[model samples]
Target: MEGVVSVNPNHVCKLHTTRSWDFLNLTLKDVGSPQESDVIIGLLDTGIWPEHPSFNDTGLGPPPSKWKGACTGQNFTCNNKIIGARYYNSDNSSDISDIQSPRDSIGHGTHTASTSGGVEVAGASYFGLAEGIARGGVPKSRIAVYKVCWAFGCSYADILKAFDDAIADGVDIISVSLGSPWPSDYFDDPIAIGSFHAMKNGILTSNSAGNSGPNPVTVSNFAPWSLTVAASSIDRKFVARMELGDGQILAGTVINAFDLNGTSYPLIWGGDGANYTIGSSPDIARYCLNGAMSTDKVAGKIVFCEAGLDGSGVLAANGVGTIMSDALIVNPDYSFSWPLPATLISPEDGKTVLDYIRSTESPTATIFFSNAWKDVMAPKVVSFSSRGPSAISPDILKPDITAPGVDILAGWSPLAPSTVYQDDTRSTLYNIISGTSMSCPHASGAAAFVKAAHPNWSPAAIKSALMTTAHVLDPSKHEDLEFSYGSGQINPLAARDPGLVFDASETDYINFLCKQGYNTSTLRLVTGDNSTCNNIKPGRGWDLNYPSFSLYVKDGEKISAIFTRTVTNVGAANSSYTVTFDMPPLISVTVEPPVLVFSYVGESNTFTVNVTGPVISQWPITSGSIKWMDGTHVVRTPLVVYNYLPGAPYNLDSEQAYTMTRESLGLTHSNVYHKTGMGQSRAHPQFL
Candidate 1:
């Protein structure tokens, strides 16, 4: 009863995977060290592919004495690089895939494990793409895999079991790339509960900010104690170019391998090739749905398909090439490579291509793979990377940071297929994938990098180092909004020496849980200890001493809130930092004790921020930041303020004043208010 309460089954979320090293400046020769070999990163996912070259050990030593976990199953064994292995599956359901062993039948675990601490694999490439020495953020660090997730999805009971074992096994960090679609209470959510225990055990947990994105309040893994990671791109990008009959050229993004070699083919729209008599209507054919386009009409022709169409299916229908458009907007910067020679253009460009095809009798176009381009405007948050205004606890920022998650090349499981389709049997040692799942391990490796550097630092201190030293800029050199990119893109090299860190201990988090209204019985279930909220005051969730500040305001209401945070001086002794505020319009911010002087390392100073602002309906979310400038170092904390109005349907507790205070900044249903005000609301000034 004290440990893993009950198991709930959930559906599986898809994959995303990694020059990542050069992108993050985490080359093995520069950052790798034996110190990291002692640092263990516990991976909770499908399982590990031990035979993969990435986990070959090579120069690694024996397992650390601190490790308490054991290798499970008959054939499953651990190497020097992969120190421990465990599996958990309480449900005897027949739907489970690969349940008899700890070995990964799915590719996700192998990919994530490699990204976190896989050994350096030279000449690593995915089908001749991203060719170079591929390595994790900290190549020398040891990895321990906990197979909690099978093919169906991760079970809540199994996840909790993995966490209990991982914590007891003395893992330095936990990297989980799974999450639910909606936010759940910390008491009920397995991730939230498991991560809480990991935090208590002095281990940092890095999690994925789910792939459901460009949508507000879709972020998962929002617990303040865990480090939620978002996905972004690096300088190198994959692209494809299209040349139309009118000499018009359009460019899009994708990992296209096939080269047309300047050859042109007859281009036909799917709708024009539809056989209406077979119920393949023009509209349905435009989408390129199954059985919508006739093989006779599509054979050897470059077919233009709509968004959501199965490119592989089109290729199966004898289509030589495919040009697809985005469903939402025309984003020239975003694209994906399909099984066939294909390119994805924006919706606007799709219209132009359609117009040209209708006008010309013999429409012809050439599609070719373009060489990798170094984006001057790099590090923009990918559209698919989940956005936040943390739905669970708006006071705390969900994604602690962003990393290079787009089109990363890493080790792949030979047992798994490269394509999404089951019949595609193509396998490779290295593969390219993308998502926050990829980003999570990037952050985890960075955390391990910091842990190796400062072995004495707590998880909170490690998290603070990363957050305070992050860079807050988009690819275009514009200041990125806080909610979109969290603190900003992670700077692994810079994080190791962050001058000051906002640190919190296990007791601090227990206090936070108490404030969240968990009673003694619930607290015991979460922490597996005799705990009570009796002596703890029901405080504000924002006062949890987080690295960032999140203040909520309801529409048409005036509110004033105070946030208290403490920073530990990790730089040189006798350092004096003067506080400076970047306040957004419609909000006024003032800090108490603007100057902090520390005469010794590890010295700490607490500061209070009093923020007053009116809820402007026009701007649903606005942001600002505070910097502690010590001349040589800048310790920054991003400040986010959103408009959250509490009312019907949600049935949020109004009895609890702090909940009301916290609920005032609700992010979940903020769109309802945005829709109601529409044209009447005046535009507010942008803050970044």
Candidate 2:
């Protein structure tokens, strides 16, 4: 928490507008109930923008009786909806850009807070795009802003202070959209420690699976007590088209608010107008770096810059427009509106554009903005969303689930620049941003929605409910793996009544920490208890009573891991479930006590799963599932078997290779295999 961390501005009340509500059979009417109004979500981030329309409390009453926090900072006041506001800056480092107040200047905390519990705002849009009645998952829920992040980054000291206060203030759910760049030990991780306390206090914590993704072992929030959320795409996407002078139109992705009025502009390559002041090479100038382009040459002409170039820099040089290429092929479905009209094309299309520019004496193109599109191939996991094989606890899946994170339109701060540039003066009440940061709030809102429905359920029970009832599907129709999506896309309504929940108590997590090698001193620091690991035997990581099953097997090693889990019946009392399982190749799974009979609600049943697998060469991770099927419900848990060698051949350069690794061990694509410098074959996987 106390690192050079950036905010996760990753949504829209587009919650109900998108397939999220319909997919889960949830309605705005259901979310606006009185029970939901009692739920308070503690947002730990930059802060909040109290005046935003989404935070309006016209219909809300006074703060819940359990609230104990207060509004801090000059002129900061909380309404019925935004019941509490507090700021923490223990590092005491004064960054010029950060305002020393509870009011949000970065826009991330405001956006996420509103996304989790904002009221409905009619005609909500980001500069007239994605216009709809924007609201959070549980619109009546209250918000308590805990300012822990600043311009420099979130500090570990500040995060802990906020967590302590927020829990004492009686927040039912904690939504943390901040994370470190890499995995760390639970004792050293601020988020892990803070969430542990929240879990102990019965507050569910939903966290972002860091944006450093599409890579293995990049997940930052791997704590079993927290709901680690991944980002995915919704059906709606924004697209821009480039109409060339030759009557051929090339389709690219961008949010273009500027209109050219059908007039075409002369397109010039950045290399042709290279400025020597910043760099000597015209090739480097093609990247459109600051001072790399000649103002006189690029002025009044559209410039085509390479992938790494900052489009805003070209605009600052008086360039009329930009045709930018992707640095990497991310979610082609998602795009952002720059300060000027720009189109982001894939590298393949970029090559074609370059060829056309070189072939013609004069090249001109017109960029046309398209209305929002609903794609058939949506709900695909965005390439930027972090993947898992949790680096901290390999036995547990990191991202508990994915949510709509790509091109999300949510409430924004009036103080923050719309284009994310310091010089840009444009501002809006709502903005579209993407990241796992955005996905965290969506899951947080959903968790709040479930919490409102079942107020007595424990945090672990709620997390288990979301994971068990989640929809399992990969980006492609084929090759669904838990490493990328965990249990899968969340289904909030289904989660409210997840027939059975893998409930864990504060003691269970303490046991997990004990097994993680935390000594008595470290355990005391984390739990604030005089607890010793003396009585607790070191438990297996796979036996943490989590909703999903994960096992790590090294290459050529035959190992068997047994996981003990307990499930509590939350559904009908007279229920009987038969355990059914699917095994991955090379791994055999068996559930002891194959059938469970429950006589009443809250009846608990314990089961043991024995998994035996041989590490298959070239295959890193493979997945299957175990389901408890009664006549009324099918409680399913994804079973992930990872053959993780310190260094493995499964790492490939393309996304296709990763997909192939999950689907089958055979590699039919030649691009996956590369000759190494040591004259040996290697699989060069793409890292974010």
Candidate 3:
């Protein structure tokens, strides 16, 4: 515990495990451990500290042996017997021989590696992902670490180099935790396009869903070939900090506020005549008031003010507390504390507690610094996670999954220049970090598990395992949290046990390209500049018919199904599952099912959906529906509905379901039948 920061001891139990409750109590031994020779997972983040105790005895130590030159010939030997690492910082001017190839200036790589595939050295957890003390999800797997994130915001250029290098090295699995918030065309995005190539080459890749929370997924790192991970608070518990009287105390067990979608900001007030009644509405009083600004309003009192307000630096400028922004922070929590407060809550609580202070007596009412912080529990998705729809294939599903992100605790480098806030403080060890920068490794770790279990599976198969087997429930609520937490939380154990899979291949993507109307030869020339399109060939043009496409049409209107997935049962190839598509009249939908038949264990299928009405132009007055049928049972596809309305262009209204039965699909069933869509939309644009 030399450099270990101790989060409040009360919350220690929560930190004992990284996975959500649903994924608890599972291990590598429980899941099948296939041959690992074919699985070389890659980590693209801050460089790793191979010298860390975790890989000491495993021979996966620091650079030179672990680190190799960026050149394909020098870096990837295709040996499969060792961990491969490379560094690519544009600012540095050194060759593989001039400087160390695997030296990590930042510790992020080390921590991420420990989480994904560490080799259980001493001082590591006995049962967790990573080799040292902890056992990573894929304990038997090897790794290929690449340093892409630099001291400055990781340049898009460095990331591209890393991607090309990873591919040239022929890594079987690639994981990238770095991303951006701004939107970009999927194909236009170099990283995304590169991931596509990696997948085509039979390399499974995973990226972070980003850490920008409470924001729509309009900004995400999307690649049809990658699994995009989103962060969720495990069990909704985290550490917190409480400042009382003049003494500050490290606190524990704060309230779980990760689900505060509509929660308001806190307001603060201070000094003489500061007496104020606690309002009945806790929602409206989320600000902190303090300093000289409180003189006119509550002279001598402290008024904690909101951070972001219109034309005002403090509450005095606005005069009205409620008119200001959300909760006020007494001071920014720049450096992360041990189990840092799960999130930063309203500063009003601190001001409220301080208001009750008496020179000669202990403050009677201790403002409950309850664990209500959310940022602490879940780090923000970085602004740089590549986003969708694919510029080249806008219709295809990209970024198949989401994982943990936010200020993740990872290895640090005292030698490296400051990257995050804590790094500037000269802290060589623990650092607080956020962004998709922390999410990508999660999927990579998962891919390692998949590769270990299904050595013969293709990149699409691995992605299918993660997505098809993903648990879409919020770890905090133990229920579904869609859009925000795609495919739910990362359940590596479940991903390993995917009963059936919907596998795709390079041919499938080529077919997808052909459907988009791109000539195969022309596409080959454009993507690879060759007559022969390798498995890693980039698609020639955009695909407007991916299953994950969004449809905005007038209410009660019908849409066409231009795309659908073909699923096969590796465990039970002969087992047949009914395939039916249903929709509400408000939003009529159809699919080409004959193309979706699963004739054999590894068979594939395809189809699409086409919206018939204008997008965001004509508003419908009603809602629409979408559903699916599987033989004797009928189930509804989650989160697919919309409707247009008068005066409004397009409104994502509530979902209305229409009945579809096994008999309708030429099958028989005796069970009671009823199905409803969970994500109900309304006729309000703001509701979206």
Ranking by lDDT: 1, 2, 3
Alpha carbon lDDT at 282, candidate 1: 81
Candidate 3 stretches with Cα past 4 Å from truth are 1-25, 31-34, 57-82, 91-101, 121-135, 241-344, 357-394, 397-399, 406-420, 423-434, 474-482, 497-499, 510-526, 531-560, 580-600, 604-688
TM-score of each: 0.89, 0.89, 0.62
Q: Quick one: best lDDT, which candidate?
A: 1
lDDT of 1 by residue, 1-688 (tens): 4354544454333232348768777665677677888899999987888888999888888988988888887687788988889887766543433646678877788888898888888898866777887788888899999988765567777888899899999999999898864566676678888999898889999988876565566677888889989888888888889999889998777667778888899999988878676877788888776677888888888888875343654776688888877454355344344667787787788998999999999999989875688876778887667777776576787678898777778877787655433344667777676777888999999999999999889999999999989987652432336666899989888899999999998788888888877777777766767777888866568689899988766667675789888888999998999999887677899999999999999899999999986646634566779999988888889888776634311212222532344345453334332321111111100000
lDDT of 3 by residue, 337-451 (tens): 2111122334554334434343415321112223323444232222223232222333343345556553344444445322212212333333334344455666677778767
User: Which ten-residue region of model 3 has the weakest summed lDDT?
Assistant: 8-17
Q: Could you tell which candidate, 1 or 2, scores higher by lDDT? A: 1
The predictions' CA RMSDs to the true structure, in order, are: 6.2, 7.4, 14.6
What is the alpha-carbon lDDT for the whole of candidate 1?
Answer: 0.76
